[model samples]
Target: MATDGQILRLAQWLSPAYPVGAFAYSHGLESAVATGAVADGAALTDWLADILRFGAGRSDTIFLRAAYEAPPEDLPRIDALACAFQPSAERRTETTAQGAAFARVTAAVWPDDLPDFTYPVALGRAARLHDLPLGLTARLNLQAFLSNLVSAGIRLIPIGQTEGQRVLTALQPLCEEVAGLALTETLDDLAGTSFLADIASMTHETQYSRLFRT
Candidate 1:
């Protein structure tokens, strides 16, 4: 469980209004929709569930846990590993941009820990500082990803607001499952199996008129 203050801080970082430019990127859902791969709310939900099971959810949650438990001296190595794991140029750029921006904003408010804070690191430290449990922190991190993905899906598929909410509601169990799994994962266990999502993200670079950044 998270202390109220910890929840508040996590909310600030995870909120869509945080100015991380999270709204501007769809994580390839836009491309997937444009190409007719994701045609409806059910399809969108399925795609997102796959991502939660095997893509960003798995990899990022592992990194978040590692950063949370790691000695402060090992942050640089973790950052390097994170940078290297991103295979797509767009994905790498997006993560770097968001992580750097997250570090900047958190630094302005809490300077002492900023130097070693990658995005996940900052989040974990904030959670720990405020006495939030690891499970809650991990769930919030995964929720942020799901929220961003659905936001992208809404735009790309042009789905109704109600429909988007439906998709999110449908994935709650899976989100909990992923969060639980994340708690026990090592960095070596981090892996992504969503090749279609990766390829779509890579293809977005050459897309003539893209609505989302990646």
Candidate 2:
């Protein structure tokens, strides 16, 4: 269990104002919207739910737990695997950029040897370093992840604020499920078959006019 102060601190670290530039990336939703694949709140909910269940979201939480328990010396290998796991150039850039930003900010605020690993790896290690509970960390991280993309959907698609909140509300359970799945998962379980989302991210690189980076 996490103490109230620990929860508060974790919230602060994952907050939208955390200087990680998470808001600037869409995790491929921008392309989904451009192609009309995600137009309304329900469609957006389906897209995010699939990602949370079978895509990068699942794999990231797995990596997060692997990082949290791995020996410190093993982090570089995990980080390398994470960077290699990105399916597209834009996806690679998005994770690494936010990761580097996360490292820089967290290093200033906490005693950290954090590196420029992908976002989940950096975050998992930081949470461990600060002694935050993995369950709460994963849940909140997953929520923040979904919320950021939902905000992007609001801007890129025709979704209204209430609609967006509905989407977020609909996806909350899956976030909890995925985060819970991360608790006992290992690197061997790391896989994401959300091909459409992957292609959306790849295709977004050439998208003529884009509001989000990935």
Candidate 3:
């Protein structure tokens, strides 16, 4: 059985019904597939694996954990950190829009006192308010990210439904590792190393025909 708080948090973040618009962004997966960078199941698996292991998984997790534990006064500093971390213009826009969306939805429902919590910070605070364990919160957030990416990949690569599920299954181990790593990470550890992804996101902005916002 689940606790009331845990259930509520999961309902808010993990539900496809949430209005965060998370389902709309691929985090650059659409651009990569359009460019023939990720064509099939194996390639999709590899790309998503790298992201979970090295990109958002590591960096966003650190931010989320720190935001979860930071003093309330430090929220603005954390938002600035989030802004600094995103190097690409499109990616930056994506995070900012999503963060804003999350803040709006949360504010409408819970009405927190802070001016605006960045996406990761708002999520951390929401998790705490909903009584979610840190690990569960991180895991679910990462899962949503991967799921959205794959959903975008399915459209861009024009793959069948089965292939998408296979890709998702193949990346499960990597996602688990990422979540475990995030649980013990510190704020100073917030970083990512995927120049290709950054470049792809930047290029995506100028792409004449884009299926995704980022």
Best by lDDT: 2
Whole-model lDDT, model 2: 0.90
- lDDT per residue for candidate 3 within 67-92, as digits (tens), equals 77777778788878887888688777
Query: Quick one: ranking by lDDT, best first?
Result: 2, 1, 3
Ranking by TM-score: 2, 1, 3
Let me know the TM-score candidate 1 reaches against the reference structure. Answer: 0.94
Top candidate, metric TM-score: 2
The alpha-carbon lDDT assigned to residue 14 of candidate 1 equals 89
Q: How close is candidate 2 to the true structure, as a TM-score?
A: 0.98
> What TM-score, computed on C-alpha atoms, does each candidate reach?
0.94, 0.98, 0.93
lDDT, candidate 1, 1-214, per-residue tens: 5578877877888899887778877888878887899999999999999988988877888888887787777777887788788858888877778877777776777654655344666666556555667888899878888988898888888888899999999998899999898889888887879999998888888888888889
- Give the worst 10-residue stretch by lDDT in candidate 1: 110-119
Q: Which candidate model has the greater TM-score, 2 or 3?
A: 2
Model 1 spans with C-alpha error above 4 angstroms: 116-118
Residue pairs clashing, model 1:
none
Off by over 4 Å in 3: 1-5
The residue-by-residue lDDT of candidate 2 on 1-214, one tens digit each, is 6799999989999999999999899999999999999998889999999999888888889888888888899999999999999999999998889889998899988759998888999999999999999888889999999999999999999779998999999898889888887677888878888999999999999999988889
